[model samples]
Target: MNLAYQAKRSHLLIGLMSGTSLDGVDAAMVSIDTDEQKNISSVSLKGFHYVPYSDEIRERLMALCSVETARLDELVVAHYAVSEWYAYAVSQLLAATGVSAEQVDAVCTHGQTVWHVADSTPFPGPNGMMPVRASLQIGELSVLAERTGIPVVGNFRARDLAAGGVGAPLVPYADMILFRDAKKGRLLQNIGGIANVTVIPAGAALEQVFAFDTGPGNMVIDEIVMLGTDGRQRFDEGGKIAAAGSVSRELLEPFLADPYYRLAPPKSTGREVYGKAFVEQFTGEARKLGLSFEDTVASATALTALTIAEAYKQFVFPGMQAEEVIVSGGGAYNDTMLDMIRQELPQGIRVTTSARYGIPDDAKEAIAFAILGHETLMGRPSNVPSVTGAARPVVLGNLCF
Candidate 1:
């Protein structure tokens, strides 16, 4: 059988995603089929699994995200260790689904984004000092392929960055495939550690799609919870902490004024802007305001909700006027956060989760990469040029067999 022919037909692929939340890995077994033009014809989720990172591993990844603490030796070791965890996730998914590694077509892994800098900075290059945008997602693809005995596709972001893109919100292309509606415009809002939205206009073509990071998602709130609990808790769980307190306007106002919220579209951000260092400043401000820890958490939750609504008001509503905002990722589980977003938005825009559309919030990203990996095998471009500000549509990811 011709390999290219097989790629166009329905095949089983597994996708692994370890998002910015630094909580765990999500593994999804997906069945995808493409049309003659290499466009997705159909996709379905067959099985899914979650593998929580040990506290030690989470700490190590957090360290790697910071420039102040990362060491080259530790980065090298963590890369290999993270790949092992990804392979373990694949093995667990295969076992739970009664499948075998040999039966699968490919494995698509996003790895772990320890550092992502999308803004152009003057740096040494082949042509002397030049402006460059860079991002690093580390999980050794060769190690994963060697362990699983299947071809692997990883580092999906690097190719986009090379093509002059921000190398983020890469899932917008997949969201278009999964959520586009003919008569109703839709906004696919994903709230990982960072929050991003894909705006698809009513009966729009591929060229009309646009997206960008909205601001902090659960990163700040999670950091506050972890700090307040002395590391006993890593997140708000169900937004309970925030629900128990009031949103401190003093704290909330400062956060809402961040310059990132005012940036134009085609922008992206990560821990570099909202990580532990930002959280420390937030906590210091809270202490000065005499606000309790719970109040600070509520304020952070409000920050995420208000910023998302503000992004829509400023960038999305003016053009697309989406009828619904479909929320996903860990933030979807936060009821208080959801309610706040609902209240902050203008009337008549429904807020819901991906589960209503047959995709689990936790598994959506992993499933997306599964689709992207299949595209790579078919020699099709998956990056959305408008969303990432790439020079052109380009096939993403490097294959390892």
Candidate 2:
């Protein structure tokens, strides 16, 4: 029960994430041990928790992402408040689980992403030099570190984006390290607001590993539920709405045709492409087709399943084959979505949650970053060039103590 015990080689981290959907804060207390050789497999999930945001806060954050910039300044302050909320979550997790944060090596926080225009944004200089493509995550780390008295490694995405990597779908590094199966080869699939997958073929070199955003995850489904349910529910509860109605391939086929789904690995997306505006378009099309609320939900779920399934059969699997697909994130909890995936998948591909292997589906993304922090502490690079198409292997994130 003494969670304060030092790791074998003096490395341990608590990873934190509050994703695009603004659902809540995820915090995981992890134990990491590594040798001088830099081969890491020793990992333990000591504790974890997902703290839901209050309705007021969730709405405020959502508004900023789509609101008038004249009111943007307040959103920046709200981001700091997010970090404080994150700190509270981390503290509650330790107290509830009997873990001591002071003993941990680092706290890896994937702060909330306000804007992720990787290839946009104006460069700051004379003569209005066009701003290079970059992104920003705006949870002040100093708040978390100062409040918790822990070394915090945040801004996980900027470094990779700066180096020309997509800076998204970063979980693949953890996938290759901890989830790879030498015999069967494995595919680690995350279905958050966006769906991404990493292919770990048996005997595959790091160069051979591949990953990318495989189209819609929960973004569309959640959005559809929001409008259809009049905000009574944040998402399609257990996909019951989807189950209640039939899908119109007409509404879904056009989405399936989106070029983003067909994009190869090293590609990334966010609320930018599939945010609320996109959902409005979906609802408008469904209405034009005379679809019911239930039908719209069903079509939205169909899109999620088809995109992921299509990405695998089309882009992810050619020379490589994965017998088992390990699923994680909020989408894994939706039975109807999973059923859709099972229906669409080619025969013999088994679907299971990452939680079955002791990683909470909701906690997996945050936990991956916690693991990434441990890697960075040990002089290991968390960005995989093959998977992310980064120009080179570079350490990700800026550490703030």
**Residue pairs in steric clash, candidate 2?**
122-131, 123-131
Candidate 2 off by > 4 Å? 1-10, 36-38, 67-70, 120-131
Instruction: Look at candidate 2 and tell me the lDDT of residue 147.
Output: 87
Q: Candidate 2 residues 1-401, lDDT tens each? A: 11332234646689998888778899888877666664664888888887998888887777766634316677768868888898998898889788687676778988887666644556667776665766667789999999898888888787787777778778888877778776887888898888888888987777778888887789888878877777889988788889999989988888777877666667877877788788889999999999999999988888888888888888766778779888898988988889989898878989999989988889888888988777666666788888766788888888777
Per-model CA lDDT versus the true structure? 0.91, 0.81
In TM-score terms, which candidate is top? 1
TM-score of 1: 0.98
**TM-score for all predictions?**
0.98, 0.93
| Number of clashes found in candidate 2 | 2
Error of 1 at 274 (Å): 0.7
Best candidate (score: lDDT): 1
lDDT of 2 at 187: 82
